[model samples]
Structures are given as structure tokens and as C-alpha cells.
Target: MSLNSLRERLIERLTPAGAWTPDGLPDRSDYDLNPDAPRSPRTLRPAAVLVPVIARPEGASVLLTRRSDTLASHTGQIAFPGGRLDPGETAVQAALREAREEVALDPASVEVLGVGDGYETVTGFLVTPVIGWLAEPPVVSPSPDEVAEVFEAPWDFLMDPANHRRDFLEPESGPRRWFWAMPWRERYIWGATASILRALHARLYGDEARPGAAVGEDAA
Candidate 1:
């Protein structure tokens, strides 16, 4: 799709009043919460992230972060700019706050389109992914205490199916485990974050376009 068309579609998809469930997306049961078993009584704190997309002169790219190792959970994983929700804050407010804190991104420059479905993490946090369009590029500096690095990935590459790989690992006694992998340069994007991206791709594009296919190509 042309950039203009893509922007229009994204705006329509992000309408505030529209449905935000990942119903027609890939079945995340293989990766998301367990339904039959009772989960431990953990606090369902609302968390949010800014899935910021920059429409660069060359092409569109999505902002991402490499977390600092000091973090107790998901310490060094590749992720979006986000964190726990604070008291009296809405999901969008939390997302903007986190982005500003982690990456020095200006909240005023982001046009929040809509939010994706909430994904419950095994660690007990319910994360809401907020999709936003960056109106203008802003200077970004990573917070040494919370962010290891901040970078951008070509949206076309991420949206393509060819670059996504399904990998498995064998636990101590259980069968092999499965998860999504979308690698770029030295960074490996996987686990809950990858699952969220997969769902987003399915929603924006179609399911037939698996992950990994558009890695090296220009946007169609």
C-alpha cells in the first residue's frame, strides 16, 4: 500500500471507538495466558507501551528498546517503550509517560491512534499496547538506568512474514517449547513482545503473510 493509503488505513484501524480485540489474529493460546488452569492471585496492574511508528523519508519504522540489565523482569529483552501503570493514570497516559521516561520521546509529537488487545503476561501484568503515529521525529536519548539502547526497525520488514521464525526449546522435563523469533542485526525479538508484534501484524496485514518474509525488501 502507498504511504498515504497505509496512513489512512492505520488511522481507521485506530479509531478510539472501534473494537480492539485480537479475535481474528493468530491464536496466542500457544503463547499467551493459560485458560483452563487457575493462575496465581497476582495483581492485575495495567501497563502500557507506545508502539511508535515513524514515517521516515525512506520508509516507515517502529521504535524499539533494549532494556537495562538492572531491571528485575525481562531485564535485557528487546521491547517497546513502556512500564507499569501509575495511580490515576489512563493507559494512554501511562504509555506516553513510559516512553518519555525511557527514551526521551516527546509525548506531544505522538498521535495515538488506538490500542491493541491487552495481553496478560506470566509475570502478572496486563499490558496494553498503544499504537501511535509519530508526527515528527524527535531527539531520543536512552535512560541509562532503564534502557540499554533505542533503535528503529523498518516497518515493512517487521510486517512481512518471511523474517519471523518459530523456535523451540526443551524445558527441564516438559516437551519442547515454542515461541516467535524476529531477529534484526544483533537483537533478537521474541517471547511476549514478539507475540504482541505477531498479533499486530496479523491485524494490519493478513495472516497469510507469515513473519520474516519482508526482511530485505522495500515496502510494496
Candidate 2:
């Protein structure tokens, strides 16, 4: 689909975001965040991330970030620029703000499309994926304290079911965890980030393609 078409479709699927919706691309009912399944999830902390799709002439690409290794959580992992919602802030507000802070992504330069379903993470975060379209690539500088690197993944590659892989990991704290993993070149994308992307893929392609993997969260 063209960039404009994609934008319009997203707005139709996810406008008036933040609230859980069963009518759109990101259907969340399939995900079961097992509370008694272990880990340290006490509550679902509200978080948001900007899924930036850059409109290139050839096609589109999704912007991704590698978190700084020094950070306490999810260090050195690939992720969309986003974080916990500040008080009184909506998901869109937090997504835009976090994007700006982490990658110098100008909110004025982006066209907000809509948001996907809210994903419940094992780390106690309820993350809303905000979709935004960039007509062209923007000047991006990673924050020294937050982002270690910035890159893009081809939209076509990401939305292909052939690349998606289901993997199992036995965490020390619980039973074997069956999660998705999408490896791109030297980078490994897995866990909650992959799950969220898979959800979006399922919504957009209707089971035709699946999210192969993603960069975010930890194995534990």
C-alpha cells in the first residue's frame, strides 16, 4: 500500500487510541499475561512506543533503536523510542515525547497515523504501540544515555511470515517460555517487542504474514 493509504488505514483501525480495542489490527485477546506464571509483574505500568514508518521512494522502513548498554533495564536491545507514560500524559503524548527525547525525532516532522492494541508485558508494562508515518527520513541523533544506535528495518522484510520464528526458552524462574524471535543481520529481536510486532502483523495481513522477531525486553 502507498504511504497515504497505509496512514488512512491505520487511522481507521486505531484512532482514539490508548483504550483497548477489539475491532482493529492489533487484537490482544490472544495474549495471556499469566500472573501466576512467575516473574515480578505486580501491575501493568502504562508505557508507549512510536512505531515510525519512514516513507522512502522505493518503499517504507521502520525505525528501530538499540538501547544503551549502561541502562538498568532492557539494555543494549533493539526498541522503538518510547517509555513509561508520565502523569496526565496520553499514549500518543508519551510516544511523541519519548521519540523526541531518545532519537531527536521531531514530532512536527511526523504524521501520527494511529495506535495499535495495548500489549501486556511480563515486565509489568502495558505498552501501546503508536503508529506514525514519516514522509521522508529525518535527522536522527541517538541520546548518549538512552540510545546506543539507530537503524531501520525494511517494512516488507518485517511483515513477511517466512521470517517469523517461534522459539522456546526455559527461564530460571518459570516454565519454558514460548516466544517469537526475528533476527535481522547481527541483531537479535525477541520477547515482548517481537510479540507486539507480531500482533500488528497479524492485524495488517490477517495471518498471511507474522512478525518474525523484534528488539526489546529481556528473555526473563
Candidate 3:
């Protein structure tokens, strides 16, 4: 689908309350924050991330960040621009604010299409993925303390179902862990970020392709 068409469909799917978390998407319902779970959280919060799409001269790409190692959680990980939701702030507002703070992305330049279902992380966060279309590319500069490097991956690469992989890790007799993988360039996209992307891909393109192996090489 064209960028415009995709944006419209996402908006239609997300505008209604609880639309994103409709009875589809198995993972949406299975998430639990029980401390007994292997990856139980010390604390959990509601958060949002902006899945910012830019119409680059090369093609359409989604902006991402390699987080600094100093962060307490998910350090050195590839992540979307987002964080915990503040008091009185809506999920969309938190996403835009976090994007601007992390990457200098101007909120005014983005047109929010809609939000995907909330992806609950083992780290104790209910993360809402906000899909947005950038009307024009803005100057992007990573915040040194919070972001190590800012990069963009082709939207087509992420949306393609053939690139989605499901991996399991047995954590010391704990629950069998499941996560999605999407390899692009030198980066191995996985974990909660990849899971959400996988859901979006499945929503946009039905699950016809078989799961593959993790993108083994480090894209760094």
C-alpha cells in the first residue's frame, strides 16, 4: 500500500477506544505483570512510542534509535522514541514529546496516523506504538545521554512478513520466552520493539509467510 493509504487505514483502525487491542493478536491478551514470572518487573508504567515514518528521497523509512548504554533499562538497545506516560498526558502526547526529546523531531512536522495495540514488556511497561507520518523530514540529532545513534530503516523491509522471525529462549526453567526478530543493515531488531512491528506487519499483511531465523549478524 502507498504511504497515504497505509496512514488512512491505521487511523481508521486506531481511532476508536480499545480498537488496537481488539480480540485479535494473541500476545495482547496474554501479557501479565506477575512478579513470579521470570522477567517480572519491579515496577510497571504506561508508555508510548512514536513509530515515525519519513518520506525519504530514497524511499519511506521508519526512524529508530540505538539507546545509550548508561540507561537503567534496555541499555544499548534499538528502540522507538518513547518513555513513561506523564500525568495528564495522553499516549499520543507522550509519544510525540518523547520523540522530540530524544531525536529533535518536531511534533508539528508529524501527522499521527493512529496507534497499534499496547505491547506489554517483561520490563513492566504497557507500551503504545503510535504510528505517525512525517510531512517532511526534520533535522534529527540524537540526545547524547539518552540516544547513542539515530537511524532509519526502510518501511518495506520492516513491513514484509518474510523478515519476521519468532525465537524462543528458555530462561533457567522459567516460561518459554517468545520474541520477534527483524534484521536490517547491521542492527538486529528484536524484543518488544520487534514484537510490535511484527503485529503491525501481520495487521497490514496477513500471516502467509513462515517464520525465519534471527538476523545473526550485528548491524552496528
Candidate 4:
């Protein structure tokens, strides 16, 4: 799809930027896959992530990053550029700020399209996925303290339902943990990052495009 069409579709389908509430629970969440899991915390810390879609001649690509291995949590995981919202900051502001801090993504270069469904993470964060359109590919410099590497995953590969993998792990305690996974080349994309991508796919296409869990064995 062309950038114009994609932007129009996103604006039409995504939640309006004005509709996002700091604590309002969106229809989508991590619990979507783990329906039988325990309830989420009553007070969810609000966080925002930028879903940067860069315009490429072949097609659009999504910008992603590998978190620094030195981080206290989720180290080396493939993720979008984002973090907890600062005091009085809106989702858009927070997303842009986090992107700038993590990958040197210029806020001025991104045209904020709209926001997707709010995702409540298993770790007690209410994440708002802010979609941004980049007219051209960006020159991103990853911060050594926070990001190990910055890369682009083809938008087509990410949006294709066939590439969405149902993966899970049986924890020592509690029920098995299930989450979305999309393995690209040498990177393993899963957890909240993959879940957000899956949610976006469902929104753009339809729930009919969502696949059933792979049976008999782990698919991660």
C-alpha cells in the first residue's frame, strides 16, 4: 500500500489521539492471548511507545531496537522506542521523547498519525502505541546506555498474519505464559512488542486474520 493510503487507513481505523485517557483501559491488552491468566493490577502505570513506519521505495518498514544488555530488565530484547510517560506528558510527547532518547529519532521528522489501542502489559504498564509516519527513512543513532542496535523490519513481513507465531512457556509457578512472536532473521521478536504488532495487524485487517495457537508443542 502507498504511504498516503496507509495513513488514511490508519487515521480512519485507529483511536483518535484525543480519546486516550491516562488511566482508561483500552479494549486490547496482554490478557487477550492469556484469557485465563490472573487479573491485571488496578492501577496501571501509563507508558507510550512509538510505532515508527518509515516510507521505503519497496514498501514501508517499522523501526525497532535491541535494548541494551546492561539494562535491568528485558535486556537485549527487540522493542519499539518508548518508556514510561513523564509527569504531565501526553502519549505522543512521551513516545517522541523516548524515541529521541533511545535512538536519536528526530521528533520533527515523524508525522504523528494517531494512536492505536491501549495495551496493558503483564508488568503493570498501560502502554499506548502511538503510530508515526516518516516520509523517508531516518538516520538513527542508538544510545549505548539504552539501545544496543537500531534496525528496520519490513512492514509487509510484520503485517502478514502468516508470520505471526503463537509461542508460550510453562512457568515454574502459575499457568503457562502465552505471547505473540515473529522471528525475523537473527532477531527474536516477542512479548509486548510482538503483541502490539499483532494487535495492529488485527486492527488493520480483522480478527479473522488472527491465527489459532499451535498445538502439541512450543512455537516460539
Candidate 5:
């Protein structure tokens, strides 16, 4: 598909009022994406992540970040630029603010597309993904305290369902926890971030694609 068609598709998916979990998009394991999928009972805090799509002449790509290893939580993980919402902030506001704080991405450089579904993480975060479109790539410098690196991943690779892998781990005290993970080269984009991407893919491709991968690992 051409970039225009892809952009149109995103617009269609995001333009509606509260377009997050449209008919085709999957919900959290809490919302019955699968009855059998394990759900987290821990209290979930509200957070927002910016899904920044940089529109390029050749193709569009989504910008991602690697969290600084020094952070207390989710350190050294591949993630979107985001964090817990501040006092009385909307998802868009939080997302934009977090993007700016983490990666030095100017909010003015982004055109708000719309929001996507609320993704609940096993780590106890109710994450709202705020999608944004950038006419062109902007200069983004990582904040050393929060971000270890900032890079772009092809939208086509992410939107493709074939790249969505089923990953799971068996904890010593409970049942196996299954989550989506998209391994791009060496980086493991898994957990809530990967699931959110899968939700977007579900909305875009629906029944047109089939799953093609599974990987396993041990968890504590």
C-alpha cells in the first residue's frame, strides 16, 4: 500500500470520536480479547504513550525509545515515549508532554491524529496510546535520564500481523503469562508496547492476516 493509503487508513481508524478500540481492534486481556488469557488484578495507574508516525516520502515509520537502564522501572526496555499522567491531564496532553520530556520532540512538530484503545499492562498501567502524524522527521534528542536511545521502526513492519509473535513465560508461583512481542532485529518490543501495536494491527488488517510465530522464555 502507498503511504497515502496507509495514512488514510490510520485517519479512518483514528478520526472517529473515541476511536481507540474500534470494532476490529483488540482490547486488554482484561476486556476479553480472550477469556482464557490471564488478567492482572493489581491496581492500574493511568498513563499515556505517544505513537508518533513520521511521514516520509519513501514510507512512514513509528518512533520508539529505549528506556535508560538507570530507571527504577522498565529499565532497558524498548518503549514508546510516555509515562504516568500528571494531575488532571488528558491522554493526549500526557502523551505529548511525555514525548517532549523524554525525547525532546517538539509537540508543535506533531499533528495529532487521534487516540487508540486503552491498553492494560501486567505491570499495572492503563495506557492510552495517542497517535500523532509528523509531516517529516523531526530532530529528536534523547534525555539521558529517561531515554537511552531513540529510533524509528517501519510502520509496515509493525502493522504487519505476521511479525506479531506469541511470547510467554511461566512464573514460579502462577500460570503462564502470554503476551505479544515483536522482535525487530535484536530489540524485543514486548509487553504492553507490543500488545498496543498488535491492537493497531488488528484494527488495520482484521481477518486479512494470519499469525506466524511463537517464542518462549522463563519469567520470575
Candidate 6:
């Protein structure tokens, strides 16, 4: 598809911005691959992330960040720019605010298209992936404290099902845990980050392609 067509199709497929509802769609979770894992009913904190798809002449790319090693948790992990909501901020508001705080991405530069599926994390937070569009390559300055590095992954690579792998790890104290992992070059994209991308892939192209269908120039 041409760049314009790709952008339009994304907006058409995504849940409209500001129209998010927890009950509106099914939620993906860390336990998706672990069917035997016991799940308890509990309150989940609200969170949001900015899934920025940058428009480049060559192709689309997604904006991501590597969390700073100095952080208390999830150190050196790749993630979207976002965090828990503050006060009465909406998901879209928090997403934009967090992006600015984490990577110096100007909210004005982003044209939010819509949100993807809601994801419940093992850490007890319900995260909404807010999709944003950047018409040009963004100039980002990663925060030294919250973010270690900022990078972009090709949208085609991320949306390809062949790259999505179901991997598992055995812990000393629990049942074997399984999660989605998409390894790209030197970066190991997994956990909640990978899961969110996997969900987005399904949302955009789940019905359009047959199982094992190859990702091509137009399919991307």
C-alpha cells in the first residue's frame, strides 16, 4: 500500500481516539500463554502508552524506548513512552503527557489515530495502547532518568506474524511461564511490550490474511 493508504487504513481499523472503554473490547494479558496460571480478581491500576507510528518515505516505523538501567524496575527494557495516569487525565491525555516527559516528543507533532486492545499486565495495571501518527521522522530526546535510549522498529517487521514467537521460561518457584517474544537484531522485544505489539498486529490484519500468509510490501 502507498503511505497515505496505509495511514488511512490504520485509522479506519483502530478504535477511535477518545472512544476507549474497558468493556468495549477483550483484554490481553501476561497470562495469555500460561493457561494453567491461576488468575485472581483484583483492582487494576489504569495506565496508557503512546504507540507512535512514524511516517517515512521508505516505510512506517514505530517509536520505542529502552528504560534506563537506573530505574527501580523493568530496567533496560524496551517500552512505549507512558506510565500510570495522574489525577483525572484520560488515556489519550496521559499518553501524550508521558511521551513528552519520557522522550521529549511534542504532543502537537503527533496526530493520535486511536487506541488498540487493552492489556492487563502481571503487575496489576490495565494499559491502553494509544496509537499516534507522526507525519515525519520525529526528533526525540530520551530522558536520562526515565529513558536510556530511543529507537524505531519497522512497522512491517513488527506486524509480521512469523516474527512473533511463543517462548517460555521455567522458574525455580513456579510453573513454567510463557510469553510472546519478537527478537529484532540486537534487541530482545518481549514481555508486555511484545504482547502489545502482537495484539496490535492481530487487530490490524487478523482477518485480512490467512494463517502463514507472507507479509509483503502491500500487506505491511
Candidate of highest TM-score = 6
* Least accurate 10 contiguous residues by lDDT in model 2: 211-220
Taking every candidate in turn, the Cα RMSD to the unseen true structure, in Å, is 4.2, 6.4, 6.2, 5.7, 6.8, 2.0
List model 1 lDDT by residue over 1-220, tens digit each. 4455556656665536144432223234334433444456655666778899886767778899999999887889999998887877777888899999999999998988887657777566778788988856668999999999999988876776677788866779755667788998889988777777777776666533532333223243
TM-score for candidate 4, residues paired by index: 0.90
Model 5 misplacement above 4 A: 15-26, 30-43, 207-220
Q: Which pairs of residues have clashing backbones in candidate 4?
A: none
TM-score of 5: 0.83
lDDT of each: 0.73, 0.74, 0.73, 0.85, 0.76, 0.86
Compute the lDDT for candidate 3: 0.73
Ranking by TM-score: 6, 4, 5, 2, 1, 3
Sorted on lDDT, best first, the list reads 6, 4, 5, 2, 1, 3
RMSD of 3: 6.2
Off by over 4 Å in 6: 22-26, 210-215, 218-220
Please give the TM-score that candidate 3 achieves against the real structure: 0.79
How much is 163 displaced in model 4, in angstroms?
0.5
TM-score of each: 0.82, 0.83, 0.79, 0.90, 0.83, 0.93
* CA lDDT, candidate 4, residue 73: 98
Better of 1 and 5 by lDDT: 5
Residue pair clashes in candidate 2: 78-215, 182-212, 182-213, 189-214
TM-score, cand. 6: 0.93
